[model samples]
Target: MEIYQLVFETAIEINPGAVAVGAALGIVVGVPLGAAIAKLVQKRAERGVKGTARVGRLRAKRAWDA
Candidate 1:
């Protein structure tokens, strides 16, 4: 990905020592950021599923009552 490549490229421009440090830091920061984004997406998906299920149940209940 361009994003992954950019990290290394930027580090290379900084200095030799910084390249390793930057790569390591990128990995460390990227993992948790990625995980958090995944979690938020999962939560949104769950809420959508639950909300749709609830609406279906409500409609079913109204039909039954009628």
Candidate 2:
């Protein structure tokens, strides 16, 4: 057998196991980080909306006074 053929056969043998391990690791590492990031974004958005509302209230109160 040629050297290239041997290498190809070895690669084919390894591919499925490599892919399964990689997928398992990705799911293990990805899910919690994704959830934490989502929570942080939600809290920041809520704070931003509250701040906007406060500013709007101040502007309306000032306009009413004027």
Candidate 3:
């Protein structure tokens, strides 16, 4: 058999129900993984902003005194 025929045959052999179940499982797993990553990134950004603000305040205080 040719490679294209073999590939098509393999695809046909897999059940549609199985494919749907796999897709559902992937969505279930992916949503929380994506949300957790977004939450982590947001936290890091907030922390960076706080640190920058603190440094800016310190600089302003020194400038005011001098």
User: Highest TM-score among the candidates is held by which one?
Assistant: 1
Instruction: Compose the digit string of candidate 1's lDDT tens values, residues 1-66.
Output: 999789768768778687888678989999999999999879988777657678779999999999
All models: lDDT? 0.85, 0.82, 0.81
- Rank all candidate structures by their TM-score, best first, as comma-separated numbers: 1, 2, 3
Model 2 misplacement above 4 A: 1-14, 49-66
CA lDDT of 29 in candidate 3?
A: 99
The all-Cα superposition gives candidate 3 an RMSD in Å to the true structure of: 16.4
lDDT of 2 by residue, 1-66 (tens): 699778756766889687668668989999998999999879978777657678789999999999
Clashes of 1: 0
Model 3 lDDT tens row, 24-50? 898999999999999987997877765
Candidate 2: RMSD to truth? 17.6
Clashing pairs in 1: none
